[model samples]
Target: MVTPVHIRPKDDEIYLDCNATTPVLPQISRAVSHTMEQVFGNPSSSHITGLQARYILDNARRLGCEVIGAERGQLVFTSGATEGIQTAVLSALTAVRKQGQVTAGKYLLYGATEHKAVPQALAHWNELLGTKAELKAIPVDRNGLLDLDFIAQHLPHALMISTMAVNNETGVRQDLATLEKVIRQHAPGVPWMVDCVQMLGKGQLQLAQTSIDYAPFSGHKLYGPKGIGFLYVREHAAFTPLIIGGGQEQGFRSGTENLPGIAAMHTLFELLLDREQQVFKPVATLGAYREQLLAALRTAFPTLELNHAFEYSVPTTLNFSVRGVPSRDIMDVFDAANIRVSSGSACSSKVTRSYVLDAMGLDDWRSQSAIRLSFGPATEQATVDAACARIEEAAQALRHSCLLLSDTNEDFDSELDGVVQLRFDAQCCYLVIDRSAREMAVIDPIPQLADRIEKLVACQHYRVKAVVTTEPQGDDSTAAMLAQLLCASGCDAERDNVGWPLAAQADCSTPVDCDVPTDGCLLVGNRRLYRVGSRQPVYLLSSPIEPTAGARVDFAFVGEQAAPQVLESVLGEHTLVCRKWDDDFAIASQLRELKGEG
Candidate 1:
């Protein structure tokens, strides 16, 4: 029997990004280390050590074949799924080249939501092979299923078709049997490649029973080590080698094999395919776990909506979005609670919107705010319970507090809570909020963002305590218009304030809150603002003033006339400095880092 492993380095941390990659199980790690120590001989060497290494390699190949239900020679060891995809694309395009003359108007088809590697590989090899074939993206419905009618329409002139068994971002699985029948019926003898990276442990694939020409898999997607994977080629499929070095894998692939990674995968395969042991959870159990997690999410967020239907997606993943919260905000809250989740494919995290969701025809809000939570097949009940508890806590925190420090007015909406910086043009305004107290203060109000600010104050039921300006204001200024708007919203301001005096204008003994601006310091709620210099007045804010002492300088708002040296004097180690003329200013992530949330 395979022993269950706890792979988390910290007990408090919960990892829910298994779709991107899984933690290396302890047994797999041990297997790798043991193989490195004991089976150190090169398989190409002509000696007893080489024989032992060869035995291990062959055994690994046998296990992989058994897991995927493929024959021995059909499996080729590869670096990972990307290499496999590249190799497959090269082979198919090479075949197109060998077939007398290239057909004009021939198109290469791929699922719109396929991993970036697939389309990129197809485009790369298609140009190099001089096929001059046009590339087409097969569309998907809102549930992330392929449009079969569109596929049938494009199949006649298609050179090669590629589709994924399961999407990496949304966990939506395609109907492989139906897809195969459609391909065979419309375009007989055409090559088809399936990206199977997300399907290894979550589902079974009988490759020999289908007409799929090539399939690629990664080890890290399962519980095995990275840098090791295998590619399955149909028994009589056209083949071309991408890497040509020393003869390896019967001249199909070159370079020395990743023996340790293969050995680790051998252990994982045994756990996956062993029917008698049943090391991994069954489909039904995993589905139940998903429901339980979904319940927790529903309880916490009343407006939560799933990006893909549960009936269509793999149980290991849940892709969803909250109505008003952005993906980055939720990610930050979860991270603060020691729970890890992802926005979308780890490869495309830098890209704000999910192309997969966009291809599915989801609304802009859902696509922009989507969050993916994925767990491994071997996850236990206790871990799920702990994750649910953390999720609830994070949701509560997000609903009550403003986690971000700065954002553009274009990106910021009225639905957010807590303190926020609404930036427009070169200048910015602040909504200093204490949500629990239902109190608010507006600093440096601008007319451009007046509507959004009024909506926020009205929606959140905040009382406008004071409208303060740190600079001179003209009659046509929108600051007065903003005050009138707030008044119309039934938010009566107690004070309409003028600019604070510089250090030279006041005595050192004056109180911080005095209208005369004594000692160059002003107090608004918990925040303390200090005027730094006489010649060029720059205000430094030591923010989120708490009852505890020793509050650090978190933000600095520079004046137009402020000198660099004056600004430098007020800068702290973690200070986020901003000026009116700055092209852009964002400190949400930096503030999280200061609070140990990032």
Candidate 2:
């Protein structure tokens, strides 16, 4: 079992949610502090302190311009990338209107997989100005790559086009070069914006070489201070100011400049650029580290699914879904293990499904079950190894937790003749067979245990005749999946043969394949399983008969919502009461008791 990596500080959270927001590096802390303390004067003050702040701001702007490859173009500082994106998009739309492009209503085209901020910004401007510009969403394929054809076809009519350089959820990179080529070929001189928040430190962007009109970035993503971001607007691009006041930010964004944030970002950018060339090169070993972690996690959970294709996404982020496990459950497991990760975008974490994954055409199982693991330049091999070990341990514990009635206890096992009983989560699945005939049948098998059932069938070399179910009223997805697996495994039993009680006939969401009536017997191999009314059975009964009505019943399966009041009747008194899950603690306590408390 993997334990906590450290114990003293208690802040040993293995942060893997970098795409949301990265930590401010200690290297830049001093710069940020010095600027905040010494350069507190307003840049517009025109005094000694004010001039000093203004000089620092100008220097920061120059460095930002150099980093983004827009030496001649202007850089506007905002609270963060969201404001920058809003400013850029709104300015472009207004410029389009001034150019008389709204004859049929101005259009703003954006990717379906873009950050919510992009579309929301457009909406905000449209509503604020009452311009009533129409918004269009460009679709992406199952791999999360933008459909260039769709964009190219719509480029001519669109007043503005917006897309992200990299997806925050899956880390899927969009090819800006190809996008620029398409725009140049089809619709030249159009405003195009890229949300490069996720790519600030992770991707080496060459905006100066491309036809990108505007690109917004966040300093925090590059290990700089939060509440600081910049917008790069290509020279001679259409522009407007959303927050106009004292004609600050080249008569665009009007606010007291965030001098400290700008200075800190300036220093971090230079360090990050050098770090990009010298140290903390995550791109070099990220893929290999991911493989190592995956291999280790797979040892504990072989059914884990990597959600994104490697070729289409960056090496620093990995999205995975584990079958039969919910994303919330996975998050809880990781949280307990001191490994921090996210189920999806932090902005849309409240939503159960990941719209990004959904737009990529993943089914409900994959999209809702995903967890994102993002690495940073500072992440080391040792940390990755420890986190992977903890992940594997958690996965193993969770995978087998369904069978555990308590931490130390397992289901009671009973074997008689050719019959066996396997209980899990307070539920029971009985296997009955005729060894001579090589025919076997399972009663009330939980679908979550399909793998275990498949393994058992293969090991015993028994041909499954049918799967008899007692409670067919709950979510039938699990039952349906189990049926499909069993049928595909060469079992003669059909998925529709999932037995349902007549009392629950109306309550069952799935169609009842086999209606199990009271006093009715289903033949399996050479044995007969009699469905007695949920009543106490008589212990003294005849046995060793033929396979017909006269045949002796081997077992009585008590189903859900059974009644009380059973006098002795048909089958023998040896009754099997199926277990029911009360709750987590109850099951754990029962398991502990079954294993004998320490």
Candidate 3:
């Protein structure tokens, strides 16, 4: 479970594994360091600091665009080249798929040694594009170059083609022009894409006139800062964004721009290009060291396999697998000897298989036993010599431990700040408030008529985003409760309170303030339920009054006796106990007369 962290040894140790990830250049380091200390303003503001940071990022975008031979605005900054690779691949595939141009039974034609992000993004396209995503690896020659003939054969089923500019392990360069020519001949309409991360400054990538639709590159690979990269979506090529948010990058990408990182990376890209020819001059100084090391490797381990042919490889990378030697033990022995190298380098820990080797049809056994020694612009001849010496020593000591095994980057336990639950268990209604949360709402409200409306919301752990009276009560108690709650909670409380009491009661438990809103309320106990709003109410209850015999309000029973007319009216439609002694029957008849005519 040990992490094979590419720990750059102290000043005493030699580190030639720059391809895995390069250390920040001193110039870039100073830029990022200084910017971090000084440029801390949000770019959204229109003030001096905001405009300064914006200017820095805007210039960075321009430089990044230029480095890729793209138009001034043809580039976009991203988290890293992994995002670049994903964005370009997914966009092209989606655009083609949506237009229904690549008809049935089509597949994504890509080089075998392309970065794993390529296929991973393709998997997403398969799910989201509503089309079967078939990923077919174009065959490669033994030296790790894509076979043009193989591509010609598969172009029929391919919707798009992707090939890396150079192999990370093999140091092999892909002939972009040759690849384009073949695509034009066979699949002319299919877009050609490339991950140019490893190829940028080593030599020229004449992308201006190629059939390449998209290209991805990382800043760190080209002497820029980490956490920043760019994608070159050709000027006219229709594209879509992968990370969609706050309408930034002309609505292509959205997030507060990492201005400092952007400025540092932008400047570095410009620096890399101006010095591109001279920048890699120091690489050639290691020529003798490479020769001596390769010779030593050939003599000491006669059966060792130089996985990549040195003839057509990048001068910066070396990949070899010693026969029957396990890469892990060798890497460990070198770690102790103050030398750093890789077993199988991958961009993301999630996809750590040696995608480069896997593409070349190398079996897991040999591929796992391979180690990569990479370099950068600052690599020195002596450093190379010291690293070569340490590698020889480590390989010999770990010979017995060379078990031909591969391991992935450690999956450390990352504790994400989990979503805080707005839990509510109200035995009695209690207000909870969390000002930091965005969407918070009430579950249940108290039905008490005498409860403090303000206290219901003021005593919470959250700032209520919205309020809903699930059940409406007729009256202003609902309105009053709402007005106080809204004032206390500082939210726009919506009006859901119709005309009903908070709870069903025997007599209308309480009335609402009609000045604001009428809380839906009802009467209980002895009072009759009435449709009361403006004038006299139409009462519907068990008790009756006497105006003539048993009329109420406008008419009543005088002298503590019922009216004769009302009693006669009641007798006609009597269904109650009207005793003769009580004269209740007569009272009912008289009441019936008031009901109309007896």
State TM-scores per candidate.
Answer: 0.71, 0.70, 0.61
The TM-score, computed over Cα atoms with residue i paired to residue i, of candidate 1 is 0.71
Tens digit of per-residue lDDT, candidate 2, span 287-336: 88777877876776677888889898888888988775567756766776
Worst 10-residue lDDT window for candidate 3 reads: 411-420
Which is better, 1 or 3, measured by TM-score?
Answer: 1
Count backbone clashes in candidate 3.
69
Best by TM-score: 1
Model number with the top lDDT: 1
lDDT, residue 3, model 1: 50
465-502: candidate 1 lDDT, tens digit per residue: 54545565654566655665563233333322243322
Q: How many backbone clashes does candidate 2 have?
A: 5
State each model's C-alpha RMSD to the native. 11.7, 13.3, 27.3
Clashes of each: 0, 5, 69
lDDT of 3 by residue, 1-598 (tens): 6566965347766776778788777778888877878987776669998877777877887776666666633677788878877777678777876786744577887777766778777777766776675778787867788888888888877877888888766778887877788888987777777888888767665566676778887777766677887777776776888888787666666788777678778657767667554445554654455666677566545557777777787777778876544465446555676766777674533433466666677765456567787777556666777766766765565353322222333211111111111211111221223333322333234343112223323333333433333233443554345544553233334333422222323333343212222223222222222222212111111233222232112111121233343333222232232221334565566556666656
